[model samples]
Target chain A: MGFAIDKIRADFPILLRQVHNKPLIYFDNAATSQKPQQVIDALVHYYTYQNANIHRGVHALSQEATDAYERARDLVKTFFNARLREEIIFTAGTTHSINLVAHGFRSWLQPKDEIIVGQAEHHSNIVPWQMACALTGAVLKVLPIDENGQLQLETLKSLLGPQTKLVVVNHVSNALGTINPIETIIEMAHGHGVQVLVDGAQASSHISVDVQALDVDYYITSAHKMCGPTGVGMLYGKKELLEALPPYQGGGEMIKEVYFEGTTYAGLPHKFEAGTPNIAGGIGFGAAIEYLNTIGLEEIAAYEHELLMHATQGLKQIEGLKIYGDITHKTAVVSFNIGQLHPYDVGTLLDRMGIAVRTGQHCTQPVMDFYGIPGTVRASFAFYNTKEEIDIMIKGVQRAVNMLQ
Target chain B: MIIEAQQEIIEEFALFDDWMDKYEHLIGLGKTLPLIDPQFKTDQYIIKGCQSKVWLRAEQQDGRVYFWADSDAIITKGIVSVLIRAFSGLSAQDIVNAPTDFIKEIGLNDHLSPTRANGLVSMIKQMKLYATAFAAQNNA
Candidate 1:
């Protein structure tokens, strides 16, 4: 089925606003997407009716909260096609999710145990692993990407040795919108007896995911990336692997028993969740998943793919615009630098025209270092984004170049 | 149509005119930052979400409030200069009553990335909280 832009745009309220006397053209989807009415309404419904601490009380309000929270978990499991809801853990978004894995999985690590990550990985994915390796006497091995921002598999194969314990890769590059060949990555990692974790923060919104079919041991996603609440996210693990790992933080609801001498931890997902959770966020996330499911992932992906093509063609026509991450089989993220213009300056100028595109490194500094540039102005798209918006973005970029040049 | 925060901030550019020269003098003033000892950059004093290495030291001289900020980066030093000019030597009520209009006044917010602005807000809030504590201590 093809994408239906008109129908999709109708669902997002913010797409209709104006900026600087011009219609608002929101192209910064990779940073965070606009929440649909269903998700917003879900948050409102949650706070208005089911507002209580979850998983710890027998009161009616607690029961409602707990049920809603678990239902969100079930929705996530279904969204990712995981085998069990217990395998999914709630988190404060992708950054926190990755940090929890780093902290919790530290016990299993050893000196010189190689942890492979990609050069294009976000700071969240890179820094935590760097800290984990630094703390645990492990070595961080990087799989380099070529000029186009796609990983060189032959180089990656050379880097993957017997000592490689874990391979963490982004399923989609947020800066470049490069849809990585994760299936191949998982297969290769498994061949070397290495566990793999995929940062699906970008991919969860654009692609359909099936954890069972991919055979990935761990996958992390942020709900805000997929039109859900800002503070809520999920970490999917194989049940056996999660059950064996240690708890990330010590607090209420994450433990089954506590005492001065000894304490026992809660099962699987709960072990990672410490203190009071974002109860409203979880329900909102579930609503976001339901909303996406209704539209169909295939429909969204196909429409966005077309938008990417249109955007690429439009962006290509602009002079002095050097596009980053030109992958043929990528999603809808287009990052580019206008010659002689600082990204911050360009972003400011674009704001004057009501064009919202992300500037700076997009939080991928290593990638910026590789390119030997400060940063790029990134215009990422969603299913609701129209070709007309890209035209506006292109005109804005041209104006920026002319004004600054 | 939304007026870019940049326009609002830029409108009050005169407040920070020659801010660079003033910033240099501020750093020179920072050299006179009171002695609390040299070993205060421990993990306890570290503030999260800063791009530059910053160390904040708070002290009181009789009735007035004084702050000492040292950063490894030049722009960060400039930022500290702006903060010092805005809040230093004020009475506790003055410190508490001072509006964040200074950011817009100097166009500092216009030049800053959103994250950097947030970090700046955190720093200002922390300084204000410190002032509040000093006020409480004196009252007691």
Candidate 2:
């Protein structure tokens, strides 16, 4: 079925907001998506009516909150199609999730053991692995990308060997919007008996993720990027693998028994979920997943692909404007620069026109260094975004270029 | 006279109701900013904590400090130009003592983004550091 974009746009209250006396044309979905009224209402519902801590609470409100919280975990597990609900661990976000995994792997990884990360990784994915390598004495390797901003799979094949302990790569490049060949990468890594962690921070919103089909050892994504609240995310791991890894943090929920002499940790997901979780955030994240399912990921992907095509065509018409990344297999993210004008200047001008676009290296400084540019103006789209909005943005960029030049 | 200069800037910003017009004015100011020497664009003169690369140089002549600055981003360059216009060709002590309330009076600080605000703060800090350095040299 064709996606009903206008009706979907109405679901978000922030779309009605005006910036600088003009209608807000938000194109920064890669950074964070606008929450639907349903998701916001879920948060309010949790706080107002079902406000209580989970797990240990004996009260009805506590049980209700616990039920909702655990149900949210089920939603995430189902969303990613994991084998067991116990495999899904709620986290502070993608960064926290990756760091948690890295922390767990620190003791397991040996000196001279290799961990491969892509050149186009967000700092979240790169820095944690770097720290993990530093702690374990493991050597860090790079998976190089070609001129088109796609990962060089041939090089990745060569990089994978007996020494390679893990492979970490983003499912979609947040900076470039390139959809990586994760399925293939996973297959290759598995063949080498290596673990693979797919950073799905940018992919969850635009595509459907099946952890079972891909069989990735670890999959990390943030709720905020997928129309959910901030400070909440999930990490999907194989149940055996998660059970094998030690507890990431020492806390109340993560403990099976507490003893001053020695401590035994909780099993599976609980062992990793340390401390008081973002209870409200998890409930809201569940609501967000429900919201996305209503529209369907396949439908959203198709609609966004249409938007990408239209935007690419419209933006290419502007002279001296250069679009980065391989457009063939990418999300609806257009990262570009016009002539000699700085991205910040163009972004500033766009803001005046009531358009919100990201203008910076986007936490992928290594990618910027590869391109030999400081940054590009990134305008990423979602299912709710319209063709008319793209048209307005193209015109706005043209006007900005004219004014700046 | 310095306060009067700030007032003039406030009045100048007041002429534009629309942010677009104000930005256009800023761009015009940026275009007219006196170019810094290529040698001065080195890492030593560059201001840290800015999203944009900003190079600032201070030259003391006749016991007065003249500030020259440049930025890769036009809006940032424009912002730097405004600061230079307010502080340049003044005595080191005078530059140090000059009120930065004009940034608020003109609503530039409020209107600027968080990153740009940080940049603005860093720019002001760099200028003040230069003023203090020059003041110490003269006193010594």
Candidate 3:
């Protein structure tokens, strides 16, 4: 598969724009990827043509909308390479997806049941399990990481026991960009009869995930993290696991039948999907999946790796710049600080130069706390990014360091 | 008098054409900000929203209030200094009534914009809050 750089860049309209009198260098892909024209057109196409509530009415528009929504589900199902179409459930985003599963586990988790969360997991991932633990009498455990932000697999092995009910970890660390050892974690957890939930929010766009291949019990990711619309995401669970877990929300379409005396719930996908739903967003998500399919994820991954290498090499040239995270195992994310200068100061200078990067803890305060720093400036790249842009950012970082020093 | 102070700060910032020059000037001003009393530099006086640690405290002498602020981030330190120059040494009523149009006039969006990266708005609000409390207590 040939990775067409210029052709890919042309697909995104925002890439053509300028910021602060300089060309826009968006290094915030982990926060959110830039939308391609195809994705935008999908959103526009949905709102323009098929605008109706899904899963119900017999009207022509309703059928069209329902088809588009289900088609998105089909795309999500295939994109993740799940066995059954019903295994994929739509929710608001990765956060929402996790909360739903965590809520379901409240009933399943016993007083002594232990849950292990990766130390590098963001507050969003941590807080939900905390709520579940608080409500149930279950205990929450931490999986420690080393200086390079790599999870201490030995610690995970030690943490795994019969009492461990579920192990939650991200496919990629949003803060350090470490591609966590989820496969090993899953296999280890399964050995002790523990299920695994992988947060694929940061990994979904840059790479493709095969849920079946990973043998992951539960996988959650947001559409917006990929080129899909925000407020739309998918949750994949094994047939038996999802069947055992109850529906997250109760409302229209999720019900098989409702009565004053008793109510029966709908099966599989619809059981979790209730209320009006983001019909337009679902359609747009399918469009995004289709768009990604054309470019090919393998090509995107290979091209992105080159960008990562170029960025890492260039960033290492800056004197006094200390980079955090595992260079060999991470995705295309560079989290670093210049000398003793605060990351916020570094980020502000970069922003002024039209190089948009994320500063602060990147919503994973534990990672920062572990490193004993306020925060690190993060520069995340995507396939659309180029070597020239990385060179500019390297010079930009050098200039920023000079000014701050 | 507060308005005059704001205009002076605004005039000083107007000399810079681009953000780089403006940021350089802010960095210089940051180095010159008077130290917050060492005693008040604890976490109690620190503002909550900023990414960097910002400690702000105020005291009233006779009828006028003097503000003291500090931040680990230099741009933020400069921002608080600029704000202090505008609102310090004013009576409680004068400090409370001071118009803050000069914030936009000077354009410290790096700190002042909705990013709330550094809380200049919170610092100003905190200063007024001190003035309001002092006014209620001493009836200035």
Which lDDT values do the candidates have, in the order given?
Answer: 0.82, 0.91, 0.88
Better candidate by TM-score, 1 or 2: 2
- Weakest 10 consecutive residues of candidate 3 chain A by summed lDDT: A321-330
The worst-scoring run of ten residues by lDDT in candidate 1 chain A lies at A340-349
What digit string (tens of lDDT, one per residue) describes model 2 on residues A1-405?
567877999999999999978999999999999999999999999999999989988999999999999999999989999999999999999999999999999988999999999999999999999999888899999999888799999999899999999999999999989999999999999999999999999999899999999999999999999999999999999999999987788888998998899989998789999899999999999999999999999999999999999999999999988998946689999999888888988887888899999999999999999989989999999998999999999999998988887
**Best-first order by DockQ:** 2, 3, 1
Q: Name model 2 segments beyond 4 Å from true.
A: B111-114
Cα lDDT tens digits, model 1, B4-52, are 3324434534544554333344335345444334588665655555644
Better of 1 and 3 by DockQ: 3
Deviating ranges (above 4 Å) for candidate 1: B1-140
Candidate 2 lDDT, tens digit per residue, B1-140?
67777788889989998777888888899987877998889999999987789999999999889888789988888889998888888899888888898887676865444456228888888899999999989989
On a 0 to 100 scale, what is the lDDT of residue A9 in model 3? 90
The TM-scores that each candidate's chain B achieves against the reference are 0.69, 0.92, 0.92
Give me the overall lDDT of model 1: 0.82
lDDT tens per residue, model 1, A270-355: 88898999999999999999999998998888888888999888888888788988876888998887675567556766776888
